[model samples]
Target: VGTLTFKDAPSMVTEFAAVMKKMASYKHSIGTGDTNATDETRVVDGKIYLIINPVNYYDIVARLTIQNANGVFVTNMPFISPDHIIQSVDVPVNKLIVFIENGYDATQSQPEKISEYKETFAMKRATLYAIDMLGNGKPVDNYAAQVYDIAIPTSGGSGE
Candidate 1:
């Protein structure tokens, strides 16, 4: 997990851009079979998992809206059970918005909003973000999530 923290949005963006550039360089080297390429970014099964909290109020669900180069993509994040907590998202996410909803009886019906959080900073393509919604803003545990760089195996196998 990264220990860096930003005091403002601009600084965050700048740091992310720099990190992205470095990651791109590493990806290029890896693509050309450079054995000495830094293991900063690793793709496991061509996907990365976002571990979301499974504990929420009854009848409430978490929804995610992701924006990338292709366009805006929306989906109901499955935080209902332990098996459904970890969501597998495709690479190169530009922005992510998460919100809690309740009281939606139909497909097209509007639900009552509980809370929302938007992250405009870019997320690395092949990294893990473990979200701990319940642990945020407490003296003991204060982080909403932590990013982890995946480790690539030496045996040419996905380290599942």
Candidate 2:
């Protein structure tokens, strides 16, 4: 049994997050989609980018435990603190870094319609996560879950 450590890649590095933010905003600027609008009655363009880090542990002892959105330490991944960030070049193929948001229950839902809303939100690819935050406003894995594969392009010039 070994301990597992997980850290939010983007959140850990402000630089990465800024890059994602720029990309998300760029999408909206180009009429992509909107996920950060205040009024639901109006359609908007663009979304706020988000991501998370979930580490799983079978049997382990943690020196630095990682906590979820609920303030509960992820039972699986253990001994992980905020400062723990994985080396970029060493990321595994199958193990992808993604984000998780607290599943919004639509606080204003009727009992009969509650499940429907939850079901839809769970599967909506367009929706971004709204996970509960820790006391310090850091995103914790709630119920909201969104996964995506990204290919970032960099600026460069080839010798002609």
Candidate 3:
């Protein structure tokens, strides 16, 4: 993992955009063990990468996305002012990450793919509220709600 720091807006945008593009796409590679991310040899790691950038860094709140082999993407978070700290929250496999911008606002809630990662194959169609999302970012349920995502990537995307 690498971090790019910039004082100017254009520099930030360009660098950030590039980083995001790299993360959201997939590639083919080969390794013998838990380290190999190129092929569909491992079921432990979801073969996908999601990259998201704060548009202009104007403000960032509520981030959401699927998960994969490399890492997780921004799902929900507050408007990212220079003051706010952006950190990587851990996510277990078979789950996605979702963070709402204003944690304080009850009405200003975000969306979570209810089906979540229930379907990892491309042929699997999506149904809203299919899975649920857990606010605490836990792989399991929260209270009576049991949060999740509306859609998830299918196994076809992995070139499987």
Candidate 4:
């Protein structure tokens, strides 16, 4: 078996404005359907936005690994839901990729074990994944819509 590398689409550049717009639009459109006020809460730092979904709060535990170009960890271990605003050392845009390994129990699986082929971001469509960071953060994917540009923002103003 080959070493698994976490790679994301270079075209999917999601901006802060766009992310907020999505959340606001969802809230506006589903004003009455929103059962919980904390259903969706996000952390916006310059451009990088860390969002948690309701499912992560209600059920299921997903392990998320965010690494910079230097391969430094961004988010903490056993990432749960309802948490927001993740900031760390400066890393170039797009250089900060995310690897989310969900589904199986944590006690049975390791978070760093991405090579296990547990599930990919694209593969988890239309399932419990609807409550993941990308799903809950942006409602576009929840509607079975194609999301390509998920641009992660950097800490410093240096737009590389």
Indicate whether candidate 2 or candidate 3 has the larger lDDT: 3
- Expressed as tens digits, the lDDT of each residue in 1-160 for candidate 2 is 1111223333334534433332232121212364563321211112222322232211111322468888997532211233332323343332334332232333422233222233465666554444442232322222122333332232335324
TM-score of each: 0.21, 0.19, 0.23, 0.18
Clashing pairs in 1: none
Off by over 4 Å in 1: 27-160
lDDT at 25 for candidate 2?
A: 29
lDDT of 4: 0.30
Task: Report the Cα lDDT for residue 31, model 3.
Answer: 36
CA RMSD for every model? Answer: 24.2, 18.3, 21.6, 18.4
Winner on TM-score (1 vs 3): 3
Top lDDT: which candidate number?
3
Q: In model 2, how large is the Cα lDDT of residue 70?
A: 88
Summarize candidate 4's per-residue lDDT along 1-160 as a digit string, tens digits.
0111112222212332343344332222345476654434333232233322332211111123457799985643222222432333443222322212221122323233222233556455333223212211323223112122222332335423
Please give the distance, in angstroms, between residue 9's alpha carbon in candidate 2 and its true position after superposition. Answer: 11
Candidate with better TM-score, 2 vs 3: 3
Per-residue alpha-carbon lDDT of candidate 3 for residues 31-72, written as tens digits (9 for 90 to 100): 335365552221211222221233312222222223556796
Model 4 stretches with alpha carbons more than 4 Å out: 1-12, 15-19, 26-71, 76-82, 85-160
lDDT of 3: 0.33
